[model samples]
Target: MRYTLLGVFCVFLIFNASQTLAVDTFCQETKTLIVFGNGIMNSEPEADRSKNRLQELLQATLTPDEFKRLEFAIAYNQSYGLLRDLYESLKQKLGADNVVTSFWRWLGGRDILPDAVQQEFLRVAASFDFSTRVGTQDLSIHLALYRSKTLEGKKIVVVSHSQGNFFVNAAYVALHSGTDPLTTNSFGVVSVANPASFVAGSGPYTTLFEDGVIAAIRAATVPGIQPPLIWNLTNILSGARTSDWKGHGFLDEYTAAGSRSVNKILPDVIATMNGLQQPPQTVQDGIITATLTWGAQPDVDLHAYEPNSTHVYYAHLQGISGRLDLDDVTSFGPEHYFVSCSKLETGTYRIGVNYYSGSGPETAQIQILAGSSVRNYTVPLPSARGSSGDQSPIPVASITVTGDTTNGYKFDIVGGL
Candidate 1:
């Protein structure tokens, strides 16, 4: 009787435990997101369209939850504006075949431009060097990746099209050279209609035969380029007339419904989203962190003045209590600075912004996170190209900390805007 009672009690206990301990089913936040880099947009508005279309497609394809969690952004390369249209006209006059070949050759570091096309090339390009322009643009791209991965702990996947590939490649090199080896794994690329000899970050890329740009490049250059994905031109054109007449458009050919490029690109992006490693969120790793971002404005500088008479800016990156992590010179800046969490300093830290270089006045937003509180300020920066000690940085806010890291830190923020 005693043995039977013991067995019955054990069974009852097991049943009760099973009923009480229901598994927690909270959804994990997605750490991966996508950023679109447009190629050869004629203007800023066109660049906006390219990125918007990609975002729309992703929104339509991904599950509602997935789409919501997968944040998107655009790295808008300054438009060629009228120069692009002029170049197109020149390409027609000089024969697309000759221009494409020479362009790729020049990009490949070849010193010699064929004598026949050299004069025309220089005239049409108007001394506009793609590589040189992209070199500057890469700084903004590098800062974006750093802000996303190293600061926010998010994985970044860049979907680059045409000329954007060059920017991605350059930015990848910069990011790799500066960051930790493990940090590079936080980035990947999906090259679309790529004209570059190689894709950066070793991610999957797709180019189609119907893409006249790639076709012209292939016919003119050597065999280093990836063979285009074969697709029936008649079928594609007949189905939809949305793509560019030359079939080199990002929205019309590559991302459009039933497009071959999308077949490869979507899966590759999803795989990368799953495969990339997630780093710990370090945005708040410091006791006081200030991040400044602006619109199409080229250069916006972030400055942090510590109470100890130490100033941290682009010129002086490190201070006694904090350091400037990134300084952006190209369009759409995210100049970032932070006070070390370990080296908590109890004093007044002034946060300042400077409209270093831009076309006109720009609205700047700075978010300062300190002691579990975040304060955001939006201030219109005048069109003034301020350098080190030449023009005073516009004071945004001041934070006064009162305690050490041992017990807990207290923050008193004073607005200066």
Candidate 2:
């Protein structure tokens, strides 16, 4: 069975092998990439709640034109509320001192939990496919954002909250390590209620002195973990209150209009977008985009067979209309594809992958953004020597476009891959 982990975002763009997607030279010269990395949430409802709040804040803050120029996405990481409740129960049963000690140990890079507790944690972790799962999912999501439509010619400002800071930081490192120096200038990060010592992407992180979680982490003096800079009285006065009891809610204490964090974030985002050199080319595709990222194994290929029987892949970079913007023959790919907005066709387009060659088994992830809908598929390529033909590659998904270029195309996920 094939399952999906959702990496939500609005739109991403990509150029050629440089791994940068672009917009047509004639499109908006500059656009904003507001990729939100949400904090720990028991459920998606809590996660989405913050995104909605942030959206509201952005809508209210930016001018009508500014808001329209924005592309938003949520890099959601799973947090089990039940596990938190379980830990509390365990704390009560085993004594808070022991639970706290075990937690600090885990934080300090050791897992010395009692066997029963460790087993439970591992069981739950497996159920969610945490380590092997979340790591790749986060990569795909942010890479999608990196190649998103907003990033075509401008920088991307990641506004990450709480645990999201950790994810964003890791992603920033991974992307920077892989891309060119110019790509580095195309990315920025803003951290809030951060618990990590280091900020990613030239960060000026935001954390309240009154924030209990960060305070506790700081009190522990965990070697590598430190609280973000303390906010001054003037800043605190504007954001002392919070919707979350912890004073860490993304909206209530951080991004709400006039809050110090928002004051810091908005200007930083604007500065990032404004302080960069444009890419060599820019092309907009509000129509469709598919991004592929895989594991350590090398030479995974992304194929997009267009409705007009045009096949786009490593062998052939451009089809009748779609373009394979990035092709990676080495390990850990982010091969991308998209149909130019101006030449969208009306018919079914199939997406597939081939484990062209590799050291060992690899898991391939493909994220598709068609119109406003985003879908993610994870296919485990157990072996190598895969062939490329109309049906040789393992099918991932299919997208059907209705309407026409004259009226604007409507993209829909037709059915199973």
TM-score of 1: 0.53
TM-score of 2: 0.68
Q: Residues 143-169, candidate 2: write the lDDT tens digits.
A: 655655433554577777766777787
- Which runs of model 2 end up more than 4 angstroms from their true locations? 1-30, 59-65, 80-140, 147-154, 178-182, 220-228, 233-245, 276-286, 293-300, 313-321, 325-334, 355-363, 382-391, 403-410, 414-416
Model 1 over residues 138-187: C-alpha lDDT tens digits? Answer: 35534544464456677888888877777787877877774334454787
lDDT of 1: 0.64
| Candidate with best lDDT | 1
Note the Cα lDDT for every prediction shown. 0.64, 0.63
Sliding window of 10 residues with minimal summed lDDT for model 1: 1-10
Tell me how far candidate 2 lies from the true structure as C-alpha RMSD in angstroms. Answer: 11.0
- In order of appearance, the predictions have TM-scores of 0.53, 0.68
